[model samples]
Target: MAGTLQFDLVSPERRLASVVASEVQIPGADGDLTAMEGHAPTITTLRPGVLKVVSTEGAKSYVVTGGFAEISATSVSVLAERAVPVEELNATLMDQLIADASEATAVAVDKDAADKAMADLVAMRAAAGF
Candidate 1:
């Protein structure tokens, strides 16, 4: 792995991925963060969004909702609450979720729930190129 970074994605249910790649893009709470082989050692909270993994092989996208990311000199480890491939995402379901979350927000019951729903919607939209 001379020029590549080792990346792993784990969830409560299972270990989703382990890859050696040249770059990785994560959806951090603040924004998107890209990592390479010599990235500084750091830890950050992942927002509900898509994690893009890129390499000479190809590119893969995963929807990750809430997680912690650890970046080091040689590796990046992500422990996610939930994760699924972009292709499997259901837009209709997400649209319904957005509507329900908006209703919740309007009622002022759970703002956090609204935020998470918005994040998920944003991630899905981005993943779908819309």
Candidate 2:
């Protein structure tokens, strides 16, 4: 059996998850990465995409608009700007998020990054069937 690491996902709204997970798939700003037990110590910025986790209970997913992830050999902690369980994502909510992203993009300092994030959100919405 694979080793498990303590994984926690939090947002300004609430703590969405705390579990012993075998793997965590992060939507990193630079790229996507999967963290497992005994992984390297590092931190990564998140982008708008689906975050996946596999644990003893089952596989779960979350939608994170942006955030920072702190990874260590024994743990992975995600502090999200906005986070929602994938199951809870609906068309109304997705539309709101897209509108928000569009506004953010207009005023963003880094236009390229904002554009990328907006693209990611669109892709996520499509994947969610919205």
Global Cα lDDT for candidate 2: 0.92
Q: Candidate 1 has which clashing residue pairs, if any?
A: none
The lDDT values for all models are 0.77, 0.92
Model 1: how far is 23 from its true place, Å?
A: 0.6
TM-scores for all predictions: 0.75, 0.93
User: Residue-wise lDDT of candidate 2 within 5-116, one digit each (tens)?
Assistant: 9999999999999999999999998889999999999899997888999999999999888889999999999999899999998999999888887887889887888899
* Model 2: residue 126 alpha-carbon error in angstroms: 1.6
lDDT for 15 in candidate 2 is: 98
At residue 45, candidate 1 shows an lDDT of 81
The list of candidate 1 runs beyond 4 A from truth reads: 92-123, 126-130
